[model samples]
Target: MTLPVSARMGGLAMAFRAMAYWLVRYRRTWRGTIVVSVANPILFLLAIGAGLGTLVEGSVEGASYLAFFAPGLLAAAALQNAFVEAGFVVNSALRRERIYSTAAATPLEPGHIFAGHLIFIALRLFLSAAAFVVAMALFGLIENIVVALAVTLAATLTGLAFATPLAAWAVTVADFPQLNTVFRFVVMPMYLFSGTFFSVEQLPGPLRAVAYALPLWHGVDLARTLALGTATLGMSLLHIGYLTALCAAGAMIARITYRRCLHE
Candidate 1:
């Protein structure tokens, strides 16, 4: 039988409640989060966008390299922060802290638990992106403040595109070391090759193809375009579609994986 609307509403309430729990806990640790999510990215912007940007004499995509590079770093920082929350934190909740077990005993279903974490991840990315944008503004990198909204949204989507799948993968991991392996091999490589520092056009044909296949490239492109106010609507829609598809598919996979792994 189909569930009643009230029941569905209750499920959503439970999910948000679980998200609130995370937020409450995070408040105590917001300092570290700010340092990692906000400070580090700004430092990188200065180090690379300003420091190295000086040695570079040409414009990228008709803007200074600092202008071109800041947005990509914002998205990359979002992806990094979101993956940590969804991947390592979620895995710890399941295996180490066993909070999911306690949550499962309540009205919250496995899907609710998964959805709650996803929601928190989105929130985290938005906050991180906002902070990064403010930093960019301080550095005179942003042409228009309103563009930060679009860039933040893109960063959030980019983050979820990676986090959802990583969450599912985390559930199956045997130990912390394996997660490190994923970061060193997968995440780090993507960070380097996703057009964060340079255009994919600079890559060899084969490497460029690989960059095209990665979600970060799409995120970087969309964010760069939006931040620079140079995005064509058609291309922006295409990038949004690509990231949205990955997020939806990954969330579905995470739901299934959580059900199986958590025995929901």
Candidate 2:
């Protein structure tokens, strides 16, 4: 049965309340999240764009090493941090915290709870990407500051794409070891191969195809082009459409998974 409009609004309001609570709670631990977000681009830029860059004498795709690197790093950081926030944090809400249980007793539905978590994840990813953009700017890596908005949108959507699926899977995992295995085998490999540190064009044929299938590569490509002011509208739309599809599909699955997990 469908909920009435007023009831739906009430449920959404409860969801927003939950999202607000997360934002407030995050303030207490903002330092850790900020440090991690800031450190990733810096370490990668210093270690690769500056260090290994010294060895490679030519521009990558005609952009300086740091310029080519900045957007990819920003997108990768969003993927990593968003995966952690959505997976581990969602797991904690399901298990250690019993947050869903508490909310279930109230006016909120399981879908509302999941929606609230996704809202928080999206907001966190956007803010983190914006901060990283500023950091990249300070290092003189950004060619166009105006494109930060596009980069941030790409990063935010990319994060949500990962976040929803990870949240759904985390609900079914029996233990932390299983989750760690996913990171080791799945997340880490995507991070390394998704054109984050270098162009996927350098990858062998099959590997390049694999990178194209992954969501992060699309994000990296779009974000990098936006930062460099070189994206064609058609390509940008394709990337955005892929990420949006993943985000929508994953959110649906996460909603169903959350209902099952919370009910169990």
Candidate 3:
């Protein structure tokens, strides 16, 4: 049941290297990504959170629409940036740019390849979440430090849950536009309907059930409940279980797909 220390360190090292690759390989792009991630969340707050709050009633997630929705927006933004890094970036690197092929030509193993990309995703998540948190602090939206940490972690995990399989799925495509469709179709819709703006109870019965089924639904649930401190122990455990299961499932699917794509 216990893994060797060296094995664990090796995995960590692989992930570090993957994250480093982004900095070294595409320094300007990575910097721009950081800037964009930070800016996008702020814009969302001003445009949607502030603007739309005017039309709505009392509040959501315990605070005004801005406070209640801010962390969820942060979590969702982090989720988005993480997937964009792993799914689109990794897919292009592996397929179009043949980076994975080049790496495979060396002594590096397949698990390292997977770990490297995942590490890159994690780095993206951390940077994006941190930036969003800073924005939150500057704008005065946070209520609890523990809630802040929990929402950030939720954002990172939520991103991983979606990104791994999405990266694999991107391998089958011949053109980059397919990723655009995925964003517009899969990521965009899940984000819009995942109880981000209004409560899920606000949605009708069937739509509410569908939203509950989405991965981001549980993710936003964790973020929203934690931000507002509304979740009971049982509900918290359920949310964690849902996210963990989705992340595991995504990793499994990514592994199988990578084998098929990279095996010679």
| Best of the candidates, lDDT | 1
Report clash pairs, candidate 1: none
Candidate 2, 1-264: lDDT as tens digits: 998999889878878987877888898988887667666666777788778877776888888877888788888888888768887888888788887788778777788888888888888888888888877777776656566677788888888878888888787675867777888899889988999888899999999999999999998999898888889999999999998888888888887888898888
Residue 111 miss distance in model 2 (angstroms): 1.0
Ranking of models by lDDT? 1, 2, 3
**Tens-digit per-residue lDDT, 1-264, candidate 3:** 888999889877875665566667766666666556778777888888779876778866457887778767876786688667766777787778998777767656666677777777776787677677766766666566776787778777777777776776775566788788878888888888888777788899999999999888888888777767676788778888888887777678777777677775
Give the Å shift of residue 182 in candidate 3: 1.9
> lDDT tens string, model 1, 1-264?
999999889988878998998899889988888788888898999999989998889898799999999999988887798778888898899989998888888878888998887888888888888888888888787767677677888888888888888888787676878888888998999999999999899999999999998999999999999988889999899999999998888888888888988883
TM-score of 1: 0.95
Q: Candidate 3: misplaced stretches above 4 Å? A: 1-12
Candidate 2, backbone clash total: 0
Work out the TM-score per prediction: 0.95, 0.93, 0.89
Report residue 218 deviation for candidate 1 (angstroms): 0.3
Candidate 2 lDDT for residue 263: 83
**CA deviation > 4 Å runs, candidate 2:** 1-7, 143-145
Highest TM-score model number: 1
